[model samples]
Target: MKFLYILGLIVLLSFVIIYYQFNPEVYSFFPECPFHKYLHLDCPGCGSQRAIHALLHLNLQKAMGYNLLLVFSLPILALQLFCKIYSYFTKKTLLLHFWYSPNTPKIIFVIVMIFWIARNLPYPPFNYLAA
Candidate 1:
């Protein structure tokens, strides 16, 4: 089952990369967030697709311009996926530790608040950090 899940995910990721490469300009099915549109502010995930697209093309500068956070997240996600695969194959559960307890709701709340506040700042370098 785990193997199947990972295989399916690989297929899905492959399809997304292909789609983004061939049809970069056709993502309008994703509706604009009203707050971002009205306020002319970026949401944390605003340029994630573009970042991924740039990453696929090996354009680091363009990816960073799109969303530095999303680009940074790729490594963490890769690590997590690797751990999952390793455990699945070895039949040994690997413990994932966090500085904070693994409380989903608290983590999500903190993440959202941080993103909301971080993207709103007008500081020169930090402002450019937003998506």
Candidate 2:
């Protein structure tokens, strides 16, 4: 199991390097958004691949242009990643003050749903939110 976990980590790290080195827009190997491809609508995660590539290169503006919500959420994701890594290495979990409320997931779900609908709206500001 540990060996498998290490292998997965290596694969994940290799992909991070690949994302940093290559632009997803110029790369055909990257996966397409099935939701967008089929429905012609931008999903919550539409530009995530391109955004990840831009973020890996430290191009915050480009990353945000690709996915505004994703850019805003990176710090939270990074914090979770930090906690997971620390716990994995130290065999002790950090007592974070997040997600203690039962309503957290429900709140997040509502937020994502709102973002999805708002970004798909065909108006000036909302159109800007589209990937």
Candidate 3:
């Protein structure tokens, strides 16, 4: 399991590095969101691919235009990675935990719903959340 995990990580990292090195536009691969084309609504992850592409290229403004959620996500991911490395070297463990009292699936559903609604809202700040 550990070997497979490490191999998978290597493969994923290689792809990410290559993709950023190339900087191909996501629209070239997926011209339009199938869900958006058919349903007329943006999914929770609508602009994630484009956002990542922009972020990897160090295009912060373009990345934010692609997905505001990424602004928070990238920092959180960096912080988590920093903590994980710090803990590993300090003989401390970082275990996963949830602050909510609700059941896991329910909490996930709620989060998705909130994201969906927030992105679709027509108000100024919230409207910017949409792709």
After superposition, candidate 1 runs with Cα above 4 Å error: 2-7, 23-31, 103-112
TM-score of each model, in listed order: 0.73, 0.88, 0.68
Model 3: lDDT of residue 125: 86
- Cα lDDT for residue 101, model 3? 44
Report how far off residue 113 is in candidate 1 (Å). Answer: 2.4
Q: lDDT tens digits, residues 23-44, model 2?
A: 9899799989999999999999
Candidate 1 pairs with clashing backbones: none
Candidate 3 residues 1-131, lDDT tens each?
Answer: 55775687699798787657654452265456788779877777778777877888888888887777766567857776666666766869774355234586697578778988888888988888788
lDDT assessment of candidate 3: 0.73
**Angstrom error at residue 115, model 2:** 0.8
Model 3 has how many clashing residue pairs? 0
| Model 1 C-alpha lDDT per residue in residues 5-121, reported as the tens digit of each score | 878889988877675665344767544667778988887777777777788888899999878878876886778777887897899976455523668559757876787678779
Residue-level error in angstroms, candidate 2, position 78: 1.2
Residue 52, model 3: lDDT of 75
Error of 1 at 17 (Å): 2.8
- Worst lDDT run of 10 residues, candidate 1, spans 93-102
How far off is residue 124 in model 3, in Å? 1.8
Off by over 4 Å in 3: 22-27, 30-32, 77-92, 99-108
